[model samples]
Target: MNFAAAVSVALNALRVNALRSFLAMLGVIIGVGSVIVMISISQGAKAAVDAQISALGANSLQLRPGSSFRGGVRGGSGSATPLSDEDVEALRETVPYVIAAAGIIQQRGLTAVVDGVNWSTEVAGTHPDYFIVRDWDIVEGRAFTVPELDGAARVAVIGRTVANELFPAGGAIGASLRISGVPLEVAGILAERGQSSWGQDQDDVIFVPATTMRNRLGGLSTAGVRNPVQSIWLGIDRARNMEAATEEITDLMRVRRNIRIGGTDDFAVVNFAEFLRARNETESQLGLLLAATAVISLVVGGIGIMNIMLVSVTERTREIGLRLAIGAKQADIRNQFLIEAVVLCVAGGLVGMACGAIGALVVESMGQFPVSIEPMIAFVAIGAAAGVGILFGFYPAHRASRLNPIDALRYE
Candidate 1:
C-alpha cells in the first residue's frame, strides 16, 4: 500500500476505537509534560543563582578564614588567619595582577539610630578600596576618604535598607549613627541592591573602616586568637586569571604565615566562577534525573500501545484475511498497523506539547519561577513521542503480518 492509503487505514482504525487510542497516548502526555516542567524549574534556579553571583561583580575573588570545602567553622584554622592591613598591602605591592584588595571585619549587633528610630544591622569594617572591589555605588554623599581609613576615623556608609530603616524619609547621609555604642558619621548611603536568591537582604548592612572595627568592636576570635579580620576581598584585572591569582596568593600567604610544605593552609579562597560551575553541574544532573523519570512513563505508555495493538490485530483478523484475499500483501498489512501506531504517538505528542506549555505557564504564575520553553526541548519531545510509537508498534505489526491467512479467514 502507498503512504496515503496506509495513513487512511490507520486513521480509520483509531477512529473506531477513539477511547482506547486516547488512553494509549495518555502516558506520552504525562512523560513529556514532566520533562518540560522539571527542566524549566532547573533552568530558573540556575538563572537566579547566576544573577546573584553576577551582582557580586566580575573578576572578584573572596578570601575567607577557613577552607570552604573542609573547614567546619568559618573562622577555623585550615582557613586563612584573619586577613590584615599588612596582607592587603603586600598583595597590592607584590602581585601585579591584583587590581585591588580590601581587609574586611564583620560585626553584627551594631545599632544605628536616627532620632527615635533604631535598627540593628551588620557592620562590615573595610577600606575605601572595598567599594571599588564590590562595585557598590553611593546614592548620596561619598565613600570614606583614604585619610579617614588611615586615621581609623569612625565613619560609616549605610546600605539602602539600613538608610530607609534609620531615616525613612531619606537624607540619612552626614548623620551620625552609633555602631556598637561608638558614634560614627554616615558618610554615604548605598544604592538599593535587592535581596539575594537565598532570601537574605543584601542591602541591610553598614560599612565602616577596618581600622575602627578592630580598635573599637574588637576582633573575631576563634580558638582564642582574637583574629581581627573576618576575610579579604580581592578584584583581579581579569576573571580568566582568577585561578592563577588565587594560587599565587595562596603561595604568598603560605610563605608569609610560615606554613610548612606538608601543612594545610589555614585560609580558604573562593572563586564565584567555580561556585557557578558546580551549581550548573548539580542542576544538569537533577534535570537528567527528572527527564529520565518522564521517559520511563513514556516507555510504560509505549507498552500500553503495544498491548492494545496486539488486541487490535486479533479483533481484525477476519478483515486482514479478506484484505489479503483481495490482493493486500503482508507488507501492506504491516504498514497499515505501523502507520496507525505512529499516528497515535504523533497526535499524542502534539497534545502533550500543548499541555506542557500550559503547565509551565501555570507553574510560572503560581510559583513565580521563570519558565523558559526552549524550541529544541519541544522538538526533542515530539521526536521521542514518535519514536515510542514506532518502537511499540513494531511487534504487533509483525505479529499481524505473520498470521496464517487460512486461520484468519476461518475465524468466527
Candidate 2:
C-alpha cells in the first residue's frame, strides 16, 4: 500500500475503537504531564534561589570560621573565631580586587518597640558598606553614614517586616525603637524582599552599625576577650577574579593572623558561586529522578498498546488472509500493522504534549511558580513516544505478518 493508504487504514482502525485508542493514550498523557510538572517546579525553585543569591550582590564573598576537620569528617568547633576590626582594615588596604567589605555581628532574640508595639527579631551590626554589598536600598530614609559608624551612633535600619510589625500604620522612618533596651533611632526602612522557599522571612531583621552592636549589645565577648565580629562580607570588583581574590584573601588573612604553614587557618572564606553550583547539581539530580518515575508511566502505556495490538492482530486474521490472497506482499502486511501501531503512539503523544503544556500552565498560575517549557523538551517527549510505539508494537506486527494465508482464511 502507498503511504497515504496505510495512514488512512490506520485512521479507520482507530476510529472503529475510539475508547481503546483513548485508553491507550491515557498513559502517555500521565507520563508527560508528571515529568513536565516536576521539571517546572524544580526550575522555579532554582530560579528563586538564583534571585536570592543575586540579591546578595554580584561577586560577593562571605568570610566565616571553618569547622575543624578531624578524621576526614567535619567536626563542629564552637562559633567561628571572631574576625577583628584590625582584620577588616587589613583586607581593605591589602586586597586590590576587594571593592567593599563590611563586618557583621548578629544578635537574635532582640525586641524592638515603637509606639508601644513590640516585635522580636534579629539585630545585625554592619557598616555602610553592608548596604552596598547586599544591594539593599533605603526606601524611605538614608543608610547609616560614615560618621555614624565612627561615632558608634545608635541608628537602626529596620526591614519591611519589622517596620510593619512595629509601626503598623506605615510611618516608621525617623522614629525611635529600643533594641535590646538600647534606644536606636530609625534611620531607614528597607524594601520588602519576600519570604524564602525555606519559609524564612528575609525582611524580618534589623541593621545597626557593627561598632554599636559590639559595644552596646555585649554579645561578642568570649574567654576574657571580646570577639567583636561574626563575619566579614566582601564584594569583589570583578566577578571573573572571585576565585583568585578568594585565595589571595585567604592567604592574606592567614599571614595576618600569624598561622604557621602546618597550623589550620581559623577562618573560612565562602564563595557564593560554589554554593550556587552545588544547589544546581542537587536540583538537576532531583529532576532526573522525577523524570525517570514519570517515564515509567509511558512504558506502562506502551505495554497497553502492545496488548491491544495483539488483540487487533487476532481479530483481523480474516481480513489479513483476504488481503494476502488478493496480491498483498508480506512487506505490505507488516507495513500496515506497523503504521497502525505508530499512529496509535503518535496520536497519544500529541495529546500528551498538549495536556502537559496545560498542566504546566495550570500549576504555574495556581501555585505562583514559574513555568519554563523548553521546546527541546517537547521534541524529546514526542520522539520518546514514537520510540515506545515502535519498540512495543514490533512483536504484534511481526506475528500478524507471519500468519499463513490458508490458516488465517479458515480461522473464522
Candidate 3:
C-alpha cells in the first residue's frame, strides 16, 4: 500500500475500536495536561517575584543591622549595631553612586482613631528622601515639607488600608487622627501599593518624619544616639554595579561605625538584584523537579500506549497474515500500525492541551494563583506526545510485521 493508503487504513482501524483507542490515549492526555499547568503556574510565580523586586526601586539597596552574638547564640538583623542617623548621612556623602538614602524607624501597635473608627496599624518615621528612594507617590494632599520633617511635625501620610479603615468617607485630606494619644493632621495619602513578595500588606502602615518616630512614637533605643534608626535604605546609580556600591557603603560604614579591618562588619548590606538572582535560581530548580515528574508521567503514558499496541498486534495477526498473503509488504504493515499509534497519541495530546488550559484557568480563578501559558510550550507538549507514539509504537509494529503468514492464516 502507498503511504496515503496506509494512513487511511490506520485511521479506519483506530475508528473500529474507538473506545479502546481512547483508553490507550488516556496516558498521553494526562501527561501533557499536567506538565502544561505546572509550567504556567511556575512562570506566573516568577513573574510576581520579579515585579515585587522591581517595585522596591530601579537601583535600591537595603541595609539592616547584622547579627549580634551573645554567648554563641546569634540575634538576627537589627538586633545589634543599630543604624545611626549619622551612618545614613555618611552613605549619601561618601558614595558617589548613592543618589538618595533614608533611615526608617518603624513602630507597630499604634491605634489610629478618626471619625469614630479605630484601626491598629504600623507607624514609620523616615526622611523625605524615603519616598523619593522608594518612588512612593501621594495620591491625596501633599508630602511633608522640609520644615515639617525637621520640626518632627505632628503631620502624617497614611496608606490606603489605613485610609479606608479610619476615614471610610472620601475626604481624608486635612482630617485629624490621633496615634498613641498624640494628635496629627493627615498631610498626605499614599497611592495603593500591593502586597510584598513576602505577602505582607504594603498599604497598611502610616508614615511620619524620621525625627517624629524617634521622639514621639517609638522611643529611642539608646540615650547616646539621639536619632538612631532601624535600617537604612539607599537608591544607588543604576549604572554602577551593586557589588561596587556595596563595597563603598561598607568601607564608609566600617570607618564611621568604628569597626576594625579584620573584625566582622556590624551591618547588613542587601542588594535586591542579588536577592532576585538567588530567588530565580531556587525557583528554577523547583521547576526542573516538576518537569522531571511530568516527564515521568509521559513515560508512563508511553508504556501504556506500547502495551495497547502489543495487544492490537496480537488481535490483528490474522489480518496481517491475510495482507501478507496478498500484495502487502512488511514495511507496509509496520508503517500502518506506526501511523495509527502516532495519530492516537497526537489526538490525545490536542485534547490534553485544551483540558490543561481549562484546568489552569479554573485554578487561577478559584485559588487566585497566577498562571501564564506560553504558546511555544503548548506546541512542545503536542510534539512530545507524537514522539511518544513513535518511540513506543515501534516494537509492536515490528512484531506484527514479522508474523508468519502460514501460521497467522491458519490460526483463529
Candidate 4:
C-alpha cells in the first residue's frame, strides 16, 4: 500500500478502538502538560531577575561606610567612618572611570500632608546626579538643578506611590506639600519603579536636594563635617572598567581616611555588576534542573507508549497474518503500525498543550506565581511528542511485519 493508504488504514483502526487509543495516549498527555507548565513558570522567574539586574544601572557601585569599633566591640555595617560630600568631590576629580557620583541621605517614617490627606513615607536627599547614577527617569517636570542643590531650595520630586496618595486628582506638579510641617513645592514626578528584589517599594518615597534635606529637614549627616552624606552611588563609564575603578576608589578612600596599607577598608564598595553575574548563574542552574525533569517525564511517557503498542500487536495477530497472506509487503505493515502510534501521540500532544496554557493562566490569576508561554516552548513540546511516537513504535511495528503468514492463517 502507498504511504497515504497505510495512514488511512491506521487511523480507521484506531477509530474502531477509540477508548483503547485514548488510554494509550494518557501518559504522554500528562507528561507534556507538566513540562509546558514548568517551563512557563521558570521562564517568568528568570525574566523578572533579568529586569531587576537592568534596573540596577550599568556598572553601578554602592558606597557605604564600614562597621564601627568602640571599646573592642564591633557595630553593624555602615555605622562607622561616615561618608561625606568631600569624598564624593575627591572621587569625581581623581577617578578616571567614574562618570557620575551622587551622595544620598535618608529619613524614614515622615508624614507628608497635602490639604487634609496625609501619607507616611521615607524621604531621600541627593544631588542632581542621583537620578543619573540610578538611571531613574523623571516622568514630569525636572530634576534638582545645580542652583537648586547649592541654594537648598524647598523643592521636591515625588514617586508614583507618593503622587497617587498626595494628588489623587492628577495635578501633583507645582503643588504644595508639607513634610514635618515644612511646606515644599513639588518640582517633578518620577516614573513608576515597581518593587525591588528585596521586596522594598521603590515607588513609595520622595526626593529632595541634598542641601535642602540636610539644612532644612535635618536629614542624616556625619557630625562635625562641613558637608556630610550617608552614602554615595557611583556610575562607571563602562562595565569592563568596574574592577579597575573599584581598586582606584579603594586606594583613594584609604588615603583620604588615613588608613594604613593592609588595613581593613573603612568604606564598603558593592559592585552591582558582580551581583548581576551571580544572578545569571543561578538562573542557568534553575533552567537545567527544569529541563532534566522534562526529559524524565518524556521518557516515562515513551515507555508507556511502547508497552501499549506491543499489546496492540498481540491483539491483531490474526489480522496481520491475513494481510501477509494477501501479498502485502512487510514494510507496508510496519508503516501502518508506526503511523498509528504517531497519530495517537500527536493528538494527545495538542490536548496537552491546551491544558498547559489554561493551567498557566490559572496560576498567574491566583497570584501564586508568574508564567510566560513562548512559541518556542510549545514547538519543543510538540516536536518531543512526535519523536516519542516514532522511537517507541518502531519495535512493535517490526515484530508485526515479521509474523509467519501460513502458520498464523492455519492457526486462526
How many clashes (backbone N, Cα, C below 3 Å) per candidate? Answer: 8, 0, 0, 0
Name the TM-score of candidate 3.
Answer: 0.83
What is model 1's C-alpha RMSD? Answer: 5.2
Query: Which candidate has the top score in TM-score?
Result: 4
Per-residue lDDT of model 2, residues 176-230, tens digit only:
8997689998989887888754678889999988878877866566543343577
| Segments in model 1 whose C-alpha atoms lie over 4 Å from true places | 1-9, 66-81, 128-157, 167-199, 209-228, 238-240, 260-264, 272-283, 321-335, 354-376, 398-411
lDDT of 4: 0.86
Candidate with the greatest lDDT versus the true structure: 4
Which clashing pairs does model 4 show?
none
2 or 3, which is superior by lDDT?
A: 3
lDDT of each: 0.81, 0.81, 0.85, 0.86
Candidate 2 at 387: error in angstroms?
A: 3.4
Ranking by TM-score: 4, 3, 2, 1
Question: What is the TM-score of candidate 4?
Answer: 0.93
Distance from true location, Cα of 270 in model 2, Å:
2.5
lDDT of 3 by residue, 289-353 (tens): 88779889988999999999999989988899999999788999899889998998899889888
> How does model 1 score by TM-score?
0.76
Which runs of model 3 end up more than 4 angstroms from their true locations?
1-8, 67-81, 135-148, 151-154, 180-187, 197-199, 215-221, 272-280, 321-334, 358-376, 398-412
Ten-residue region with minimum lDDT total, candidate 2: 219-228
lDDT of 4 by residue, 50-157 (tens): 778767876789888998766678889877878888999999899999999999898889999999899999999998888888889999998878899999999999
Winner by lDDT between candidate 3 and candidate 1: 3
Candidate 1 lDDT tens digits, 321-412: 88887888999999999888889888888888888878888988897776777677778778988898899999999888887888888888
